[model samples]
Target: MRIIKNLLSACCLILVMNSCVKSINDDLSFVDAASAPDKLSVMFDITQDNTGLVTITPNGEGAVLYDVYYGDATTTPVSLTAGMKTTHVYAEGLYNVKVVGHAVNGKKTELIQKLTVSFRAPENLVVTWAIDAVNNFKVNLSATALYETAFKVFWGDVPNEPGQPFLEGQNVNHVYASVGAYTLRVVAYSGGAATTTYTTTVNIVDPVLIPITFESATVNYAFTNFGGATATKIPNPQINGINTSANVGRMVKNGPEVWAGALLTVGGNIDFSANKVFRMKVFSPRVGARVLLKVENLTNGGIFFEKEVTSTVANAWEDMAFDFRNINTGNTYSKVVIICDLGTTGDGSANFTWLFDDIRLTNQMPVGFLTLPVTFDMANVNYEVTDFGGTVSVPATDPTNGANNVKMTTKTGGAQTWAGSTIGAGFTSPIAFTATRTQMSIRVYSPAAGLRVRLKVEDRTNNARSVETEAMTQAANTWETLVFDFATPSNGTASMNLAWTYDMASVFFDFGNNGTGSVFYWDDVTFLTTNVIPNYLTLPLDFQSTTYPYPFVNFGGATATVVNNPNPSGINTSTKVGRIVKGAPEVWAGSFIDLVNPINFTVLRTFKVKVHSPRVGAKLLLKVENTTNPGQFFEKEVTTTVANAWEELTFDYSTIPFGFYSRVVLIFDLGTAGDGTANFTYYFDDISLN
Candidate 1:
């Protein structure tokens, strides 16, 4: 009894402890009833078509709740329930079906299933021959597929063997060594399953031989310096054996006379019944000269057919053919004579040098052929602002180069302006426009003689100034068109302005410049849609002096430092050192430090640089000094920037400057700014000359 009472007590204690532990655990891991759900099951039906409709059914016990993922976007959560089918029109592709179920005890389980929605195989595979050559050929295969299915092609010469098939719309090139009949097959496949096969046969034949003939009889010709002298037969002159040798007549260049001559017998007793039209090969120097082939019917002694052919370039042989079916054969004589005649001589210059070969008669009918014609299109028209003293004239004229050409100008000094000044009399307006195209083009014409014009185009959308200019020369009273292609900016807006100017004074006709007979004309400016952009700029050296206080430094080892002052005063001030260079080592040396990665800036069509020089007529040096290779420097002489005041120096960067140059430069030799004095200073700022 005592043992039983003790066991019961122990059991009660264990039971109470177990109950307490269960209560504590349940309280700690309790989940909200609304937040967590019980057993979840998902059953869905999906069509193998493009309409990705999925009907799902969820079945479970306690508080059954479910979350579903159609495998499209996880960010957007989708709640699913039992017996609720959702139709999702998704693109045809493989998708993962995800279902999540949770219990009130904070326990959850996820089940993922893969579903494939595929497109049906395309019906009616069509195959066509793109290129049909004698031995080699190409075929284009095409077919339609179900909206959801991706397709591929299988092709081979055999009907059903394992062969290479390309994707739909692929061109397949096939070559056969020997000419024979071959079968071409195409099979369409969806997913990994073959859907249908298309087969066809192509018959290839050997090259055919055709006979050629001439219409003239035996002829003789003299020699000359012009072209080689050779005799040719005229209308309906049948030469024997065209297929065996591919040649029928004899051609000679060396002769006794200064000019070559030929004679043919038109008398009877010749059978000309085996031939139709005439054909011959002539060899002559291609110095833009002309040669003639003449034929006379034997029925009549008069010449009835003749043809002239021109030669291009030099030292080339060309084939000449003529038809005599339309010739008027007079009654009586039944024979014909032929002659090869070189055109009239130029003042009896020298011996005619001409060679003739391969004269044959053929009965084949001529075939017709066609060629593609060249075509052009235009788009994107815009206007540029011109600063003509706020004048709204028919065409505003630019005063700097003063050819009275119209240009768009901004109130800001040194701002870009556009004008049609190089072209004859045009209108100007301040209407700016942007092009949807990636590229822009324009055509201009010059109407004056001995005058050349330049067209300038400026991009308004780019914060960095960029311009493109093209120069064209024109004959007197002749209209010529010029084209400018500007790369589209990344912003997708391509805005531009056009202008014309006559910068060269040596040319006779200056449209905008001061000249009595100089006039230029322009028209047909246009922009086109393209995907090409300007090649990225390449900077040899970029002097982004982040490490040093001063970006550029100048210190000549032994050269005189006439001026030594480092204060940004907007101009080269006196007290900076000046070096007098004479014979050897003729350079005022300077150094610049680069502190950052190279930055590429475009060379605008037109930009000006300001330089302060001390001396006149002395060469100043502007060089792209590379820190890596100090010896490699691009130097340009500063010719006309020598003035006490700041002188605006302009440079045209259409052509690259000479010398090995980096993006950063060390400038020296201020001879043109001021005389080499003890306190000579050169100031440079607003380096717009790109």
Candidate 2:
């Protein structure tokens, strides 16, 4: 009786403590009451009729109703009550049908089912195909027939197979993505009553419409005379070797016409999606003759992209390149207009006659220092920011090298001294560093010159292995390409090696300088070599490399970045360190690193890291998991003994079961939730096995 009474009293005390803690927080009441639905299922069966009628049945517990969607011509969803069947007609083809179940508690679940329907051939079909004169290879289709309830088209392009179906009198348009021969087919149906199939051939080839090498058979290339300028296809009239082509476009600009030029209307729109740069041969009347090439849409002549270039050589054929990278691919352009000496009228003399040939389009960037090893910002490669005091954005304003530039704005009240950013910690590809190519070049636009620019490189995971260099500009207020030799820093330290795989890179506009709220522009970061040292557990990991994602897999919204060591001491004394900001809503926000080989437990049983926390007595947990079996894990926790200082914590794993441990995990304040604030932030360096 006494034991039972004591147990009841203990339970009451626990309940009172829980009640007090709960009363302190009320924000969590909606966490569980409103959640997304899960485990929804949808089953469907189509009728054998060529008419795409589909009967859909949705199944899910706790769901009040179902939203059925037939991924076809239909845009609206079919709302179905619980336990009721819904039907949707889909033509004879494959479809990705979706069912979203709505639960009573404001939750939802979804499932997608691939539905295939193959019916007997449709009937009473009338199929017709016409190529779009505006968009090359884009065909306009028409299908009409008596007793036809639906129509289907197999455009014969591999991607448009067993194709989509539509109703009669509907105009179906399809754009062929590539150049090739295609067999266009159509099927008509009478709503599962009868069906018929029709087929035809379509030839799609790249436009040979440009360069007016009239050598080929006489094809009407409508090079019409405009602005009193006339151009005609003729045999090479010049006796010079430059006129090697059998035929060329000869143009004569008559006087009194300042915009005297010729216009060639293309049968299809000029595609500038992939290739934007254009090159054309021009046999000019003289050097410095201004030649402007412009393209405008057939209907919307206002939507156009044009470039003007001067003839470099006199009385000789030369290739003039025009940059049209700013054009939008969504617009159509079919008319090509050329203007000679755009400003001054030309005389109908021998000097006004010119011949040209071999015009083409390409997407290559100009050859220069930027494109040599690697074109910075090429293909829009992502550069992840580790730290930023204010905001960073990519704007296409004034690029020194390519089509874009990166702008960095320093916050007014942000960190003054070392408020910097780093990118590519876990860089997938490492740039190779050689003796001759040990320098990195960058184009910068600073608010003022003479400000020190710092460049740093490190192993994304180790701080002890780092190199930094700084350069001050002699001129400011203008664009300048600065070459940084990776040999010394402002601290008078030299750490450069040809064999080092220095991948992570960071750039600072002003080293150790306070903020003046400045905006900076930089582009074209050129490097010859680049992270991570695998195996050899004896090697301590010091997060020094500027290349990043940092060599760690972070989870639970934890943030980790390599920065200047806040506290470097003991055997892990290094200039760089790993800073971790524990996230909220999770008691265990942490990260893990995968080693190349399994840890030799018998030889090295102690896991060590020099951790610096903001507060003492914070719980820090270190864990190891079997490489092959993540569930097979071992963990140890230690409390921080010192605050705002570095202390080495050694975890003894000698008693752990023998296993291939290849992953190491770290968690700060293991059981206590974090707000991702300054108080929950921590730093660690020299993660090694003892």
Candidate 3:
């Protein structure tokens, strides 16, 4: 009976197990038709403190678990249940976070959403800008900031300009249309919505070019130094003479290598077509210091040309010239290298330091003699005016008119009564003072009226042969032309002698009075017969006057005077011809004879003159203008067919109306300013109307 009961219990247990299995199978069948996860998404909670901390919380319907991808370069994905979040630290950037949702039916659902791991606002944002060394109009911009990923720049050159995006330490370039001051704005952005902005005023200008005056505030004079040499732009230590500028370039050559120096980018390839010489004002510590100026290709130092000059004046400023006439013009040069005392090493002392300014290139080489019409405006002319007795003279701008350049002469206190300045070292030629042309005029701006100014001309070879004259200033602080008549000698001075070769001139301001710190400005040193039209000149001007002043007004680097005929044969043979030397470094060099009375053009419309030229095919322009109105002018050009011989040139004025012209102008070789040579000398005489 016990065996039978156990068997029945086992059978009941088996039946109950079969019923449980059938219920499980029915549940599994229902799960097979269930859908995958729906509406899968993620939410990011970023930290506010620039820490780039993000809390990723994923959500989905019918999803039991999720695989969260941080979107960055993470090797493994994070697994999280529903309603659970994971913390991640990311750099400030944009990211597309991915979520893989797993449902109860073993189905997977994946979705990608943009994730932004933004931090707080950027802090301590710094922006820097620099002018491009090669292109003056171009600027390089960069920025740095804490907790910043990228930057946007507003160049402020256009209206409604869009921002340019760049990363940190990346150089953003901008080109300006012109030179001016512009507002530059840079925005530093964190990965989040926070941003930091910095604004600054940037000055745009032309890059440092041929004439590197070291005066531009916008130029990046960041010289590239090598071999332990240091170079910088500094305030001028000694400002006097021709260079009165405020800034200069200083070079300290206390380096280990003898060839230590600095190089500067001169913006572009140096134009060697026009100028071939480089000039600079240098203040050296001692005499005989060699200064080497070299030009090289912008990238290759091996392709270079150099010139060296030695300083003559110790502890004083002097203009030095470096000749680069043999430079290879075919090669391009964009850098200037300066090495002082090139063969010796510096000790970082005053002896090793040099100050320089007014670096420029020119075609005018020093001729060693300052010539007539000293305007002080010519490049590389070397108006080396010497001062004595505590008088200082320098090139200065006109006080009344800023555009007009003049010379400033200062007589400091405790100066000699005869404190004066020489006009220059000496003139290339002597002052030819004829019987009638014995006067010289100077435009003077005095500190006070009634100041006596003395003009003296002497033979440079012999100082004893000098004539001095005095003229009183009639205006104060205004420019007035004062005539000094050497014919009437100053008191206690020798009279003018026509036989002496007066090749040097000197000027004394506030004559006969001890300097009380008086200052004077003077310009336009002119030599003339007279400014007063004492008598009207008529036609048939033979220019043979020993008593009557021809009064030929010269202009544009011309020196015209009446003298003995140089070539007195062939077609004309006469003394006291009009000589014109067009060698004063100008192109439109000529002279005009201003007549007080108009020429008789009604009777004769044709004019003739005898001319002597140095070259054939030389252009001679003869023009006539209204006596008072220079604008009303008529001109005719003639060419010379005979070289170094006398010839008659005819000018017909048939179209020129009567009573309209009183000035007769003459120009030889009207376009070329020749070097000081005999080839530029010309002569003419026997002007008559037919």
**Model 1 misplaced stretches (Cα beyond 4 Å):** 1-63, 67-119, 130-144, 147-155, 158-162, 206-324, 327-690
What ranges in model 2 sit over 4 Å off?
1-212, 238-243, 299-301, 365-395, 398-690
lDDT of 1 at 660: 27
Looking at candidate 2, the ten consecutive residues that score lowest on lDDT are: 530-539
Local accuracy of candidate 1 as per-residue lDDT tens digits, 475-538: 3343333333332121112223333221110111122343332233233343344433221212
lDDT scores in order: 0.39, 0.69, 0.82
TM-score of 3: 0.32
Which candidate should be chosen as best, given lDDT against the real structure?
3
Which candidate model has the greater lDDT, 1 or 3? 3
- TM-score for all predictions? 0.24, 0.38, 0.32
- Clash totals for all candidate models: 105, 33, 1
Instruction: Using lDDT as the measure, name the better of candidate 1 and candidate 2.
Output: 2
Candidate 2 structure quality by residue, lDDT tens digits, 1-690: 432343345445545666776455434345237556567788777665455667888887766567788889887887776788888767667889888876544457888888887665544576777878767768998888765677888889886377878887789999888777898878776655356778888987545465445665535555878777888877776646555777788889896678889888865678786677778788898888888989999888789989998887988887777778678888888888888889877788878877777666865323211122332355534343444553332234453545554544453345466666565343555556664455677677777755667778777667567777666554555777666655323233345765666767777777677666766676667763532232122135676644222467888868777788765665557899888898877888888875433454544678788988899898789898875789989999988898888888888888998665667788998878888888999998888777
